[model samples]
Target: MPAAMTIDLSAIPADQRDAVAAVLRERDALKEINRRLEHLVAELNHAVHGKRSEKLSEDERQLSFEDLETAIAEVEESQDTQLSSKGKTRRPVRRNRGNLPKDLPRIEHVIEPASLECPHCQKMGGCGVMHKIGEDRTERLDIVPAQLRVIVTVRPKYACRACTDGVTQMPAPAHLIEGGLPTEGAIAHVLVSKYADHLPLHRQSQILARSGIDIHRGTLADWVGTAAFHLGPVVDRLAEHLKVSTKLFMDETTAPVLDPGRGKTKTGYLWALARDDRAWGGDDPPGVVFFYAPDRRGENAEKFLRGFDGVLQLDGYQGYNCLTRPSRKGGDPIRVAHCWAHARRKLKEVFDRDGSEIAAEGLRRIAEFYRVEANIRGTAPGQRLSARQARTVPLVAAFGEWLQEQRLRVSAKSRLGEKLAYIHRHWDGLQTFLHDGRVEIDSNSVENLIRPIALNRKNALFAGHDEGGRTWGRIASLIETAKTNVVEPFAYLKATLEAIAAGHPKSRIDELLPWNFTPSS
Candidate 1:
């Protein structure tokens, strides 16, 4: 133990000493946390830019930095949850822009009479001449020769006619890709098509070739790589921002990575951390961040969530057992709220395999819990808690009584017994929602967030390498976070790229966050 933790309570009276000792202990623990964080930051700096780290490629460094920031952000968020109280946060300032995206080129055509004579002159029995007063202009979106159109910027030079003088013209604007042909909108389109639409680069390349653009797959990959490099900071900031919430849903999925040595693909993992407070009427915008790792080790989770002490609503993955174990102070490190969907899925499997009455009754009882949840969603937290207490408490008690009764009758070695045992093992975690209505009946919120990952896996087959998986995770986090906030991914990403090209200040980085984003026309 550190000397700071060992305090002498001898000078104070017994009645007041315990309270003073408790506060001192908390203060010391916080100090220790701060020291560890500073040391961790120093180590990361050394590892990232150390003498022997020269072998890493630029793409690998980009991916690693994004993942490293995720871990840093999670630890910070966890610290915030445990140390601070909820406070009103100021929303980002909205930008005033037109509905139509600016800078698209326009072509003009006009119709005019051959002669300046009014046709009404003969009909009205009077001589009259047509004169131009004003013109009505109508604009319509038109696709030119190809689906993709080139935007040419012109700078008109002006100088004195009589005397020689230096010509003056506006300076060239910076682009997301410096000295490149693609627009920010074009790059954003490619990203949305690849990640959201799940059209792999080869197919997108083919599509572009047909459109007469002739961009190769490797070139498209380069564009994606550049976009990921710039957008990585936004994802890091997002992950850090999300961890500040009191509760979050977490889950992981397999990501296949190519292994050169084995000549076969290796298994990787993409972990998702989610926040959706709308169900309980919280004002914060919903978001999720995806993290890629080499494997699904519990240490990865611990590293990702080193300082988080908030409630985590997740599935029954044994990897999370590390969090439930007693900490140095002999108290639970984190609140592990188990998913009821997982518990019920076991019963459904047994019932599906064998027409068992026990499994049927379990499903029927769990259904009641969901039925109650459906009604209270989107209400106030207090209202949700009160309703759960009134309507669902009895249902839970009756279900518990019924479960214990069945556990005694069923054989220990039987298939039904095993399913019942699974539920019994996770009984405490399953009951977490009974006390707090802010949590859901299951971890389905995060489960829904990974649907796109599965679709992309089917389309792309596997990531090119482990670092590629990290790149995939970073880009997908922004796209998916945008969807949750009802923001269009392409426009949000385009505007984001435009800001980055214009040198958006790091201090105002939150303004680029999806929830704070205002869609461009």
Candidate 2:
């Protein structure tokens, strides 16, 4: 072991103390640089050989700086407590494995012994009988392949016995498509398969073919178009419902559509608006609506959100910035709440690349705000507002000051500098959560709602045309919203189509929404 070196300030001359302090600062800087270099090498190695997403794995947590801070806090608290504590330490307990859902019907198969006679007295055939005993049981999951069946409707003709009366027959039931081969259930199945399961119509056509049913892909497409036409009223109502919410989360994702003459796909945008007040314990049910636009211009957002006048939570996209700007017509501008996750993501990238202390500190400060949010997560809006005012407000103020100080220290052109500038620019929007507890700190809810569209895009590659894209959005909106409401998409869509076929009134369309829908047996 090396001997410890100690410096006594009193022994040193006052003039030389300044030089000593300068040397100590240089040593600390060198140590920090070395630490960063080591971290960078490790990160590079992981990037080359490990999983793509930057999310920490179980093993990676051991080296995580955030985990380090948590461990230190735990150690400090443990040191403050007595060794023989009265309270028990909460060791993590393993939970019992859950059985299969009781809702699923079970079929049993029993295996019997080949010989009923006892082995001890087989020659004598003891007792000439076998007594009852307990039996062992096990379960195995099974699936039934898709089967196609035809429904034959026969209408009996009736004629009056009196002379020259016109023949009368029972009117046929209302079908989604008059005289069409597919039933309402079949059409609902295709829609749910394409939109919810991300299966393209072409693949569905092939699957149907395997089941000995040959329906052309073009015909399937027509069926989808018809479904969209009939579901249009429901989509309109859903959009209106989403807009009426006081707080809404908005996001957009790229959707490619085929260009007829160009022989290639043109980029389109799917704008998603979602309302989820469950986090703040509000009574409103969660729902999402999607709109497809040919372009991602500011005018499109303006047009789509024309009637919406409330807090709009979104990311750092500049197109949405126009919504908050003073319009030439002069009206109440939509209040924008910037996503803290986006801001934190920028700094996280910096940390991942260079492991800079500045980025880490920024994340640490932002994490403090989220910590406050976690404490008030499921509380009522009033309680959440009170908690935010008591805890988050002061922390945000201090973080803002620290950010300003950081901006002054870093080079303006550097990556970290650019990120700090973004934070400073959106400071007011980021602080919106401090004023209104109903607004989320990030627009992750909307982003999550857009992920299904991204998956569908990956599978279908591109929509056939702009109209097809619009149809895709309308159907996906209902399916996803049903999923959000915990309603089975197929059951909801089937019931909805049947109701529409039965001439359900447009004036009472609210009952057809996913939240209010009741599945038919």
Q: Pick the candidate with the highest TM-score.
A: 2
TM-score of 2: 0.80
lDDT of 2: 0.85
- Compose the digit string of candidate 2's lDDT tens values, residues 307-387: 888898998888887788778122359999999999999998888889889999999999999999888898888888899
Error of 2 at 237 (Å): 0.5
lDDT string for model 1 (377-485, tens) is 8888888889889999899889888989999999979989988888888888888888886888899889889878877887888888988899899999999999999
Using alpha carbons, what is the TM-score of model 1? Answer: 0.71
Kindly report which residue stretches of model 1 are placed more than 4 angstroms away from their true locations once superposed: 1-146, 157-167, 327-332
Clashing pairs in 1: 78-308, 99-521, 101-521
Model 2: how far residue 79 lies from native, Å? 45
Per-model C-alpha lDDT, please?
0.84, 0.85
